[model samples]
Target: MEKIERGKALKTGRDYEDIKFRRKVFMSKCVKKAMSLFRIVTLIGISYIVLSPMISIISRAFFSESDVYNAMVYLIPQNGTLKNFKLAILRMDYWKTLGYSLLYIGSLAILQLFICSMVGYGFARFQFPFKKLLFGCVILTIVIPSYTIMLPLYMHFRNFDPLHLFGLLGIGAKNWLTTVKPVY
Candidate 1:
């Protein structure tokens, strides 16, 4: 080995290979650490964004009315009370409201599930005309923005006269806006 030392003891063969190996190892470790730190920060930021609203709502529920007017009150209320909770439950008749809501939502969910399952079964068991096209449409609906169809749907329901049956009875296209008939 020729001893040439301007700064580092520049090595040849095995020593130089070892230095290269060490550099590669260090670089890999640094990259791994950077990636992990990035992932942790990303997760934390997303979690905060998703959870902060729920946290704020729950925190506010625990707060007294005085806390709302107080500028100093923040995440934790200075004087907390269950009055808000009690008043809401009492005024709304919480149990009855919850029961009705759950019944309505559950029935809708079950009906939707049943209809989807029947459609799926029909698709799987039968080979009908334009089957592929229909399936493509079904799949496409998942990707399509709902708002794209909303205007057409709104217009259809807005001027719904169903075979001119209502028109025969001297009634014109009925505006079914905000009516429960459209829900069905």
Candidate 2:
């Protein structure tokens, strides 16, 4: 057996092997430390990105009108007030607005959840004609931007006529957008 000394050239095969093993371990430790540091930096950056808008909005909500206009006050308002919240509640008709919003959004979310689940289950379990085409159409809908279809949808709903059936029946086109029928 040969004794290995730090910062000294290897005198035997055993010493060389020992030095190589030590070098490998040292390199692995350095790499691990570097990776951990990198991970911490990346997490911090992501946290900042996600939280920055929320922090700004919360800070701004507390700011007075004058504080908002003042150039000296940036993130933290010099003087904070609840007047903004009071004004918002008054102007928005808090209870009625909240009720309507909850009714509309909650109904839509519940209906969408059930509808999507049923559709997904059908897709998974069924073997039907034109399934591929139907799936392709679904994919196409997902791929297409909502804004692209918004104009056509708006126009259709504004003067909703189904294949001129209303014209044949002598019933005039009803504006779906004007009525609350579309909400249901």
The TM-scores of all predictions, comma-separated, are 0.76, 0.67
lDDT of 2 by residue, 113-184 (tens): 999999999999999999999999999999999999888888867878899888789998878787888776
- lDDT scores of the candidates, listed in order: 0.91, 0.90
**Least well predicted 10-residue stretch by lDDT in candidate 1:** 1-10
* Strongest candidate by TM-score: 1
Cα deviation of 174, candidate 2, in Å:
13
